[model samples]
Target: MVAHEADYEYVIHKFETEYYTYDPEDDSEVKPGPNTPDINPKDVKKLPSSFIPEVKNECAQIFYRFKCPGSGLFHCILTGLVFDMTREAELLYKIIQWDESVLQPAGKMAAGPLFDIKCCEDAVRQLHFPHCVKTQEALLSDGLLSVAHFTDDAMSFIKPLKITDTHVIVDNPHLSAFGLVLDFLMGIWNKQVKGQVLLFLSPPNHAKQTQNINVLLLPRNIPMTEVSKHHQPSHFILVPSACNLIKNTTYTVHCPVANKIQPKRAEFDMEFGPNYSPTFVIRLPMNTDEVTLTIRDQTDTEVWEHEADLTDHLPFSADGRIPAEKIMVMLLDILEDLNDEEFKKFKWHLKTEVWNNISPIKENYLSKADRNDTVDLMVQTYEITGAVQVMENILKTICRNDLVKKLSTLRH
Candidate 1:
């Protein structure tokens, strides 16, 4: 036993020394590319609605549409953005990734996702962008927040008309790429703000002995719904507490047993964006059951630390079981075929007591659940129970034999 233990320890020490040591060859700077063109309106199928916008997810990109009968307020169920419309028109919008290097000269940083908005008529009068700052009142009073409006040739910042606890209000004279920004000139660069540390374990590979764990340090207000839209295949680690992070401050991640850690350190920018790239990537042995993750500022003061369990987050599917994300995509493809009434019946079937013993879709959730919401709940159910068969049975009960067959094929 002692010989075996010594051998394991020596292997771990060698692995750490060889891979964790800083290597000059591994250092490479990645430059952000130019922003891609906005999606053509003709390609998107518009869903007409008077109140709630019809939301769709295509290839991890979310699109929203709303039909305005007259002047009223319209809220996006996915993104918290609100639109004030005047006269009848059709509104279409989607969150698009943009190169934020342009904001550096102005000493401004993105505080929310950049939305590419298109309207059939010049009817929108006001726009509201959701912000996650807990001390929004103080920030609003200090005038630290502003809106970034990007046109074809130029980018401009607009002062907000009003600030609420949840949203920043601005006048929408025209439609283009609009997002929220915070100015460092207002003394917000060093301010400690609400922040989140998101952890995602990559899908396990049986042939490889090491796996990558991606970490994202972002503003707390950036919606998880938006993040999940991009990272469906990875296993999300739910952190229990929120951390306070200083904007523009450099932070370092430390894991004593990690085989390798990339980038060495990352700056915690106020980038709440359409693309959520991982801040750090830590590679560890596949057999590592637990690890202590620590985040420290440039000053070497520890900001956040957690001991994460690897068992539930392994994301290995060696047992012939389909991944939860793949199941979610398949379910979404099947659900898209259902019309309004048929979708209603599907929700009703999900709410039945028979499913309660397994993983019940909540009554309140089903009351107004949309297609995306339903798929999310089903995925959660699968994760909790590990019972893909239950979902197939439910589909069979609802006379969705076509969907049931698809689910069966996915399971095998």
Candidate 2:
């Protein structure tokens, strides 16, 4: 995460009390009387909660406090004035502390005490609102500290660290993704001497609420074990898109000591590539009406593209042999019932059920194929499991027990 420019400085203010005890208001901090004000702490109850009385004649030490309102909107009492603290204020509070130089002489040991503002007339505007408002003008006119000027001076002293948010394009391009994350981490840790750090590991091109797809939400304070939970071998694959995957999708696959495929998968196209590596290309027969591609890894474990979508290419294994025909056959059987509306309802229910498995609805990687679309188009994209389960349930509902039994036997 990048720090913002306003994060470096902590704002400090000093309040002068003319009355020993007084109520706080925008224009004044004393009783509404013609008599000049004076500081008398015996009437502490009348002071704002943020103010603290001096102890043992320690003039150099004063105290104050601020609060963050849930609305992100801050307002004042004098004619209901308002101002917003920048989001970067969080970093300021986290990194810096109050300085006591304002109260102490050069030789005295500074006790960093928070400062309070009198008249409450001072109003500091955020970066977004540069010009002074009516309340600020009132404070300035009285030679009183206005919030706007205080914020301006404090912000000027801030020097935030530069951070750049970027995306890693992984469309099966020539780049090796394995080392990218490691290098990124090294750069961040090495460059910044101190601060909170977070690294998000998003999923492969799946958008979620307010966040882009495939992005992780990692905070520096998060436990290491939790951070590892989102890790996947695929994160290291730098492909332009799912369809553009090639043998060199990741760097780890090319390790000389690693289990090697006799012929490199990169040498072939989608139709004839070896699936012993991270990716393979399969060329469906040009004239073929339907196709299914079941991919497996070196462990002989089948790989499922749970998030397959109409926009993605046919699914293939990360390694090992590709079972293209088996998936196609199952899909073709479903196409036989394409005209059935009840079958369409079953698909909707299935998608919803799969989606609801997570507490909040996450990105739906499963293809949203419509019955009105060509059977070939639907068959080419969806994973065999979700499509088959929806079809089998539909078949059973329509009293086609015979077909359901056959599907159960042939689920690959």
Best by lDDT: 1
**Model 2 TM-score on a 0 to 1 scale:** 0.23
Q: Model 2 segments beyond 4 Å from truth?
A: 1-167, 170-181, 184-319, 347-351, 355-382, 397-399
Per-residue lDDT for 1-412 in model 2, tens only? 1101111110000011111112334333212233423433333221211111111112222121234222122322111112233221221111012333421232221111111232121223221111111122221222111111124234111111110111111111110101111111111221111111111212332232221112111111112222222232222111111111222122111212112222232221111111112223222222222223333333434322222121222222232112234544555665565456655554444444331121211113123333422232222122233345445555676666777766654422
lDDT for model 1: 0.63
Ten-residue region with minimum lDDT total, candidate 1: 41-50
Give the residue spans of candidate 1 off by over 4 A: 1-62, 66-74, 85-90, 99-107, 132-142, 152-155, 221-232, 255-257, 272-275, 287-292, 299-302, 307-412
Candidate 2 overall lDDT versus native: 0.24
Per-residue lDDT tens digits of candidate 1, residues 126-174? Answer: 7878775655334544457788999999998887765545567777867
- Each prediction's Cα lDDT score? 0.63, 0.24
Listed in order, each prediction's TM-score against the native is 0.56, 0.23
